[model samples]
Target: MDDNRTDKVLLYKGVKTMIFAVLTLFMGPIILSMALSQPENKLYIPLLVVGLLICAFAVFLIFKGIRLIMNSMFKK
Candidate 1:
């Protein structure tokens, strides 16, 4: 309804969208590398798990931001 909410929506969609998307995207490489490597490599399990978890969390954040933007758009 005002400039403050407009600014919030802009920041939400512009900054947060890119940040979360990039974080989630990078997780794929980490997960893939672990899967392709020897099973016994010490870091594989933890890295793979943590990477997937972070990816999931980032994706959730991205979705939440998208919902915020969408709701804001429809309200206008």
Candidate 2:
């Protein structure tokens, strides 16, 4: 990649990770609320599962971003 494209990608990646973190933080409480509101029929299970999946995906992306930054730093 060209130098400008590489720099842009790195900046965009940091922004993406921050956005992902914010989304996870915001969704977590809402999901937990939905899960807790209904108790008898085990309604929370599906919500919990989906929420965890999303959170895991976000975390994975964040880690990938960090690794990319580290690799670039070391390469430079």
Each candidate: what lDDT? Answer: 0.69, 0.70
Q: Report the C-alpha lDDT of model 1 over 1-76, residue by residue, as the tens digit.
A: 4453454656567567767678777876668677558678887777777767777877777777776676655554
**True-vs-predicted CA distance for residue 55, candidate 2, Å:** 2.2
What TM-score would candidate 2 get against the native? 0.61
Compared with the true structure, model 1 gives a TM-score of 0.59
After superposing candidate 1 on the true structure, give the runs of residues whose Cα lies further than 4 Å from its correct spot: 1-15
Instruction: Identify the runs in model 2 with alpha carbons over 4 angstroms from their true place.
Output: 1-6
Ten-residue region with minimum lDDT total, candidate 2: 2-11
RMSD of each: 3.7, 3.9
Give the CA lDDT, 0 to 100, for residue 28 in model 1.
63
Report, for all candidates in order, the number of backbone clashes: 0, 0
When summed lDDT is taken over every stretch of 10 residues in candidate 1, the lowest stretch is 1-10
lDDT string, candidate 2, 10-72, tens digits? 756766776777788678767867777786657678887877777777777777777666655
